[model samples]
Target: MTTARTLAVPAPAPDAAVKYFGAELGFEVDPDDLVRDLEAGRTDGYAVVETRAPEAFARARIPGAINLPYRDLTPESTAHLDKTLVYVCYCESTQCNAATKGALKLAELGFQVKRLSGGITAWIAAGYPTEGDKAPGIRCAC
Candidate 1:
């Protein structure tokens, strides 16, 4: 009687599921939502941050993203950034952890941050336009 969908593993209680998903939303942003906000010019409260190296950023990146490689994240380096803005951090794709690292670093530095779910790969896959020479199909060499 046990099918794969109804195996020993069960779903969380509805309340737990709600809390978990709500918390997840607090820490992540969908590519489509971000693009929609960008198109509507509703980006006043946040900043898109590309966490790749300078070369990778130059290759291709979200149109208005500021490059801030995760490795270089430090208080002094991030001092000029506005503390009031939420930094949406992302890198190549799900294959890269730079976004998570960058988000954590920014948080540690007393900044608000969120990870761009699926990173640049998802953004491009969603048909959003990027800015750079290798846009639209830039693969992660990292």
Candidate 2:
């Protein structure tokens, strides 16, 4: 009589979920990296896309970032954008999912995209500068 063989699957390591997810589909950028990229002029091939409303954008946003609210994304609206350039999407804060939604839409449209991990709140908390009528120049010394 022949015995049937069974395959055994190993269990995931403890506290490896976050890392596994990050590694499987990495698309998050921290505030420091964003700032560093901007300072190095390496952001020429990227676009910091604010995925919030116009009012929110007008109130305050990343320097040189363009407004493209998640709710308003459309084929026509994004038609003029450069597909070759990577798009960095951010919303209000870590609690907000607008940036994720926007990134998904952009990805579906065949555009490379990444989501700002903690969004604008983290950026401001990191002492980064915001641009708007109320906010002037760079808030950071560097």
Candidate 3:
């Protein structure tokens, strides 16, 4: 009998799994959940941030997302953001890391932060609305 590689490591205990999954939920928000919140106008406690270049953001982005490129996330630039609201950061897609970088910067700066799971790719794939010069549902080249 051969042990499958998938079972090389046993799964965590149910209690530990619960804690692990629950903690992951706190760090990421699904695109569908975000759209539901936006559609319902329940976004007062959180702000969407696009962690891409200004040109990329202008080409296509979440309807209410503020462009704050990860490379430019600084105390001076982020001062205008509301500290009370959790900032949800996203980049081109799961293929990109700008969102993670931005989230880390925000957290280091003492602000609440979460990453938009799968980023804009998942958002468009879900048929969520976006505002930009490009048409909605258009895949980003990135």
Candidate 4:
């Protein structure tokens, strides 16, 4: 019998992380890029979808983003949507997986999908505008 040998592997660099689009998960849109597209109306048949709950969406959402909570997505519900448009799904923040779930659902329904990197929180942090009645309004702490 031949002796078995083991090989040691070194860890990746501290900075080695998926900064932009992740290859394994396909394309991902950075917050700035998405904002540019939205501002310039250069979507090119792309749809930015908010995958969070209605309440979250109603409170605030990226300008022009349509609300389509992940839990309510289905063939029937999505029938009216253009299948050719690339669907970019986003949720609360990087910590939220709702966007990923929405992307997968859209992809299954034959729509090209890209997850929005960093989600809505990142968008707000980037100083992009949001649309909705419940969006942050004038506040006073007198």
Candidate 5:
């Protein structure tokens, strides 16, 4: 019996985060590639920011992820932050606008941030981790 849950085409050299620099005040990241690296513990100097609320972070999250809800971002947020060049912002899903909003806000603050192309939903759909899916989203009371 043939299983329909396999990639028809074998991926070569693993997926790489595709940088879309020409976008309006932002860029997109290939979540598939990001998840691969994270799972393999091959992630480099990039910073993965979960735009989830603190309560959500307390519940669960991707290991090594920094919790910074979209509402907390400001010109001062990047201060004393790591020297990481790439900042990936992700929320609940592609249907959620928090990541994009946060990414744009970070860009305005002069941070090189990118939205996790399609967000965590895409990552989970790609068979990635859902360690934090149990944590519901926070819509920023601010």
Candidate 6:
């Protein structure tokens, strides 16, 4: 006689296009790799764009990121030069889609784009300081 047993296993999810740019306009980056690249300062081929507004941005942002605010990338604003610039967009929290939307908008305007893996929240979480807000805030990790 013989005994039979079954084992349970989990499968990895399929790639569902986490980071995307406009129709064939930019290169995309996964969260892990993007963090590595940014930390190494190998971002010469990339530019970080903040999708937040001017008022909100002044309170602090991703240090050197540019202010294009997703809504501003219209036909009028897309006239800027530097088509060869790679872009990464970010917003408030990692859960927010503003960064992704901003990246897509830039791509639609013929600019290369990528979305920040977790937005500004991730940056600050990583201990990278943001330049804004004069008040001192505490970081609490759950």
Model 4 spans > 4 angstroms off: 1-26, 134-142
Candidate numbers sorted by lDDT from highest down: 1, 3, 2, 4, 5, 6
- Can you write out model 1's per-residue Cα lDDT over 1-142, one digit (the tens) per residue? 6569666688899999999999999999999899999999999999999998888888889999999999999989999999999999999999889999999999999999999999988888888998887835555534
Is 4 or 5 the stronger prediction by TM-score? Answer: 4
Which residue pairs collide, candidate 2? Answer: none
Model 2 spans > 4 angstroms off: 1-25, 135-142
Q: Give the per-residue Cα lDDT of candidate 4 at 62.
A: 83
Local lDDT at 119 for model 5: 65
Which pairs clash (backbone N, Cα, C closer than 3 Å) in model 1? none
> Clashes in candidate 6: how many?
1
- lDDT: which candidate is best? 1
Q: Quick one: ranking by TM-score, best first? A: 1, 3, 2, 4, 6, 5
User: In candidate 5, what residue range of length 10 has the lowest lDDT sum?
Assistant: 13-22
Instruction: Give lDDT for model 3.
Output: 0.88
Q: Give stretches of model 5 more than 4 Å off.
A: 1-26, 132-142
| Candidate 6 local lDDT, 1-142, one digit each (tens) | 5444432343334442333334223444444566677667877877777787766566667667778777677878868747887887777765566777777888788887777666667766776757777334322111
Candidate 4 lDDT trough over 10 residues, lowest sum: 133-142
Candidate 4 Cα deviation (angstroms), residue 10: 4.4
> What's the true lDDT of residue 106 in model 3?
92
CA lDDT, every model vs. true structure: 0.91, 0.82, 0.88, 0.79, 0.68, 0.66
TM-scores, all candidates, are 0.93, 0.78, 0.92, 0.77, 0.67, 0.67
Report the C-alpha lDDT of model 3 over 1-142, residue by residue, as the tens digit: 9889999899999999999999999999999899999999998899999988888888889998999888887999889988999999998888788899999999998899999999988887788888899745434332
Alpha-carbon RMSD to native, per candidate? 1.7, 9.0, 2.1, 8.0, 8.8, 7.0
Model 5 — TM-score against the truth? 0.67
lDDT score, candidate 2: 0.82
- Indicate the worst ten consecutive residues by lDDT in candidate 2: 133-142
Clashes of 2: 0
lDDT value, residue 76 of candidate 6: 83
